[model samples]
Target: MQIQGLHHAQITIPKGREQEGRQFYCELLGLEEMEKPEALKGRGGFWLHAGNLQVHVGTEDGDARSATKAHLAYEVTGLEAWKETLRAQGLVPEESVPVPGMERFEFRDPFGNRVELLEVTEDPSL
Candidate 1:
């Protein structure tokens, strides 16, 4: 059987730092917060409405996040504007490796999670 698409993705923040996570993911990033299920409400962290999918930020011991290359890359429009927006907040966007027909950059969230924003420069077909 063919697989379906992603339902959600999860990232972690240091335990007891949920407010910081919310500030970065919500206030700065512009993702809207979603209510957690009752059974999951007691757990730390929150969910975000990201396009059609959800991003679940869970709380845990997040000491090693910056040491890994694992990250989330979001497809967006107006790449240059995004870069400026990030810079305005004192966040530097690092140039990413070249990928045909795409312009992109990455930056670490306050909690060290690598977040990428990319825009299609040409038809995506290869």
Candidate 2:
């Protein structure tokens, strides 16, 4: 048997700072907050669903550095509209880059988390 797909993803936020995480991931990014399992709630974490993947944010012991190198990429249909929406929320969207087979733009979340928005187009050679 082979691995099918990713079930969940976890991001670390400093202890007692989940509000900031919620503001960015939930409010700004438009992800809906979901309740964590009762067993895992004691650890202080929240879950959100994106498409079919689950994103988990857990509180860490101390001041944790932001993950700039790693990022979550989201594919959207209305790329321009999304860019405008981000700008209206005071989040700047960088110019789209040609990724050989896709179009993408990079933006940072309120917590300085790097995220990429991508839209795939029909291959010219197809």
Candidate 3:
């Protein structure tokens, strides 16, 4: 058996904090927000896309904890411009990430979820 690529990744934010999710994920990060399916519309969250990848931002209590170590890496274009934009918002990333195949840096969202923006220059699948 083989596992395919990811279907989606979920992150939690406090209830009534979806607006901040919108500000960071949509407005600041440039992810395109999409309508959640009808069956899940009332659950109090939203979906976003970067390329074909889905990130589900869900609502929960303020006690929702974020991992300080793990994060999601999204392949990006115009990475230098992103650095400037994030810096302007006081969301600076640590740019000295020394991954051999990826030029990447990581930052935290408003809800404290860690995320990495990477430009992969090599095919690891080879």
RMSD of each: 1.3, 2.8, 2.0
lDDT of 1: 0.90
TM-score of 2: 0.79
lDDT of 2: 0.79
Question: By lDDT, highest first, what's the ranking?
Answer: 1, 3, 2
Q: Output the lDDT of residue 15, model 1.
A: 87
For residue 110, model 1's alpha carbon misses the true position, in angstroms, by: 0.3
Worst 10 residues of 3 by lDDT: 62-71
User: Which tens-of-lDDT digit does each residue in 7-77 have in candidate 2?
Assistant: 98887777777888888788867898988888988888699998899988877764233545687788777
Query: Which residue runs of candidate 3 sit more than 4 Å off their true CA positions?
Result: 63-67, 123-126
| 1-116 per-residue lDDT for model 1 (tens digits) | 98799999999999899998888888988899999999998888899998999999999884788988989888888889989989998898999999999999999988888999
Candidate 1 ranges with C-alpha deviation above 4 Å: none
State the lDDT at 67 in candidate 1. 89
* Alpha-carbon deviation at 92 in model 1, angstroms: 1.6
* TM-scores of the candidates in the order shown: 0.93, 0.79, 0.86
Which candidate model has the greater TM-score, 1 or 2? Answer: 1
> For candidate 3, lDDT tens digit of each residue in 45-70?
89998788898889988643565666
